[model samples]
Target: MENQRGKGLSFARRIYRPRIIGLGIGAISVFATLYPLDLPNWTWALLVFNGLVWPHLAYQLSTRSAFPYQAERRNLLYDSLMGGFWTATMQFNPLPAVTILSMMAMNNVAAGGLRLFIRGSLSQFAGVLLSWALFGASFNTQITALQIYACLPMLTLYPLAVGIVCYRLAIKLSEHKRALSALSRTDSLTGLLNHGSWKDLLHIKFHKCQQRQMEASIALIDIDHFKAINDTYGHIIGDTVLRHLSSELRRNLRHDDLAGRYGGDEFCVILPRMSQSQALDVMERLRQIFSQYRHPQVPELKVSLSIGLAAFSPDFQDPSSWLNAADKALYLAKNGGRNQTANNAGKSHFEQTQMA
Candidate 1:
């Protein structure tokens, strides 16, 4: 299901909390190794500067710094290389902290490789393995089976632990984005697709119809004397009327049909696999349903929809032209009598309406 996949993807992109945990471990090591042993003045100074550089730069580059993909990659690669040089400077230090720091550098490199190569799962795994092997071999002259076992525990679990945390966060962030997107494309009052999305829907549906040679119809529905409702009651009541109509429209429409709030008190429907006459019958059903949408708060509230049908056939040039034909019939319905439907297949007025 889309919902479940979307949830999984969300988890993939969250903040890696282990980075902070690792940094905290580093901080603890600083006091245990540096303050107690008090290494050379130069070593202390260099360590302090390197400490500031790694966290600050990592936070800024990952969160704030935006660059083209290739360029960002090159920068990360540079950091990974410099990391080695930074660690090698303290090889002569008496403290084993530098030794542990070097192992941490392997971590930094593995983490960097993961960040750089999104699709290259093989490359990421290999890089992590190599980093771990080098880290083990560096501490001990020869990498024995015991050393390899010690490295395996962290190497196998670190990425997984951090990855799960991030994956969970990404889902929540994505939901926020999806909700905002939905609001933008929706009419708040009607809770239906607004006019903004209509053009795109029309094109997409047109392609579908053309491929399958599926009969499709467009209906323009305008609520008659809707202005009177607003005038007699309040705009608040008028808004409630609109929302009520929208709910019924959504319930009545087929899954494939699209209902949109075209503008103030005007609505439209796009019904697939329906000819003009069949569409008219559907509109009448909708009309009969609309006539009953009175409220206990406003008993006088009454509205009727005038719909026009246009079927896409060989005569119609395209979906846009077909919609225009529907609009022409809508005009006729409005002028002739309110709450009626007209079919405008192969009619000259449809072409004229398109030109206008």
Candidate 2:
């Protein structure tokens, strides 16, 4: 269910923002009609500021030239100036200025929250609400009772709608982004994470072990004679074998366990908070599971796996070293015989093979 939902969110990211743009245009049109060209000088200036100048300035200061986080900050500056100008205009002609400012706030919240959704940040709405509140407070501070009472309701209503729309949009975008990220990091054919995920996971685990003195073991598992399975039984059946193991490994392992496709017919597992002996037991269980199963197409799908595991230690300062030691153990397993498990607690007295 979770994976299906993630896929659906991925589909939504491609469609949501462009749809919001149409809504934005309609909102802007309404704002323009409410504050026509007949307004007083102060009101005219405020309309131009909020309707055109602010967005243009925000684009100039932001967009392509600055980093995302930096651009978000610059947006606040532009919004503040626009909101201030709009608030002063509201005292002169309270109705139109309020509507224009509301439109601006709504647009900001929409765009900022959408961008934030993609980038995995949540603080973008701060500018929208803050600017609205600043304008509202400034109006209340300077105006007499009649104007204040007339404008305050419009002030609250517009910002509230903007906030709500933006809030919902932000959540949708966030979910979509997360799902896309997950998809990018995982293998499409099998459920396991991909090569990129493996590299990233290794780096993260190594850093954790360095900082906290945690024990970690990694298993490199390869289906023995996988090429023969593909050549003899056809690639379709071979793919089925790989898919089946991926499901089995994911089901068998603990929640903290991570399995990734290292390459063709090869998979790697990172087991946090586990000793070398424990890793071997897990590998042995995998061997038994594959042995017990048979493929209908091949009939004799007696495929065996070779596993090489290594415990992360101080000498394993780099990710390459851990992989090297694990690969060496793997080589020994393949050399001695197929269907065996090997592990190194630290650097073995023998040699460790360097991996490409």
Model 2 weakest lDDT span, ten residues long: 347-356
Tens digits of per-residue lDDT for model 2, 165-219: 5677689889999999999999998978999888898999989988998998998
Q: What is every candidate's alpha-carbon RMSD to the true fold?
A: 11.3, 12.8
Runs of candidate 1 exceeding 4 Å displacement: 1-151, 345-356
* Candidate with maximal lDDT: 2
Query: What are the lDDT scores of the predictions, listed in order?
Result: 0.61, 0.65
Could you tell me the lDDT of residue 111 within candidate 2? Answer: 54
Candidate 1 on 1-356: residue-level lDDT in tens? 55644443332223224544444344333333334332558655655554445545554454433332333344344443433433333222323333344444454444455444332333333443554444332332333343344334344454565566556657867998999999998888888899978767987888888888888888888888888878888899888878887888888889878999989988888888887667766777888898887788877667777777788776666778878888888888788766766668433333445666
250: Cα error in model 2, Å: 1.0
